[model samples]
Target: MDIFDTLDDTAIEEEALMYDYLNQSARKEKIVRPRVDHFKEWDSAEFHRRLRLITESVEYLLFLVKDETETKTQRNQYISPMLQLLITLRFSATGKFLCLYL
Candidate 1:
């Protein structure tokens, strides 16, 4: 009965219609998209080198942050030690949450 409720219903109906259209097109055309391997691109030597460079850059950034945090904590009387959390992308790829405290 409310305007917001009507807007929500319209959005949900649009999503359902879009999915139904997609299913019908897939059945009619039988189109199959080529499979993609995200890791396959990382198999090359150049990709390895690039990955190494990225890793070093990230490590350097971590080091800078850690050093600055330690320096600030040492001078502050009420501040506590820094807490570092290292979370990877693997869990995010699967729509999961993972917290790793280091």
Candidate 2:
């Protein structure tokens, strides 16, 4: 005569079904965020102006950080190291970042 014995099978099944429904709805609501294609859009001078780093220097930094910043997953992977580095540099240099909307 414990609490576990008092609970019915129907209650457990209902709770499980509720959780499954919530999970399904959440998966459906998943949003794909837009990313700025800065590398392709910006030229060498723009890189220098925004990040205060030359194009070659940024590429070198990307090389330095590639091992540590790389994500192992192929599906829904994190941003590239170069982009991460560029964002950091941009924030440090200009103290400005554009808002990302969902």
Best by lDDT: 2
lDDT of 1 at 49: 41
In candidate 2, stretches whose alpha carbon ends up further than 4 angstroms from where it belongs are: 1-7, 22-28, 74-77, 98-102
| Candidate 1 residue lDDT tens string, 6-98 | 677779889899999988888865455543333343445543343333444435645666655454344324332122312223333334444
Query: Tens digits of per-residue lDDT for model 2 on 1-102?
Result: 898798899998998999999888888556878777888788887667778888888889888889998888846746877788888887888787752325
The count of residue-pair clashes in candidate 1 stands at 0
Model 1 TM-score relative to the real fold: 0.21
Please give the distance, in angstroms, between residue 9's alpha carbon in candidate 2 and its true position after superposition: 1.7
Worst 10 residues of 2 by lDDT: 93-102
Candidate 2, after superposition: displacement of residue 61 in Å? 0.8
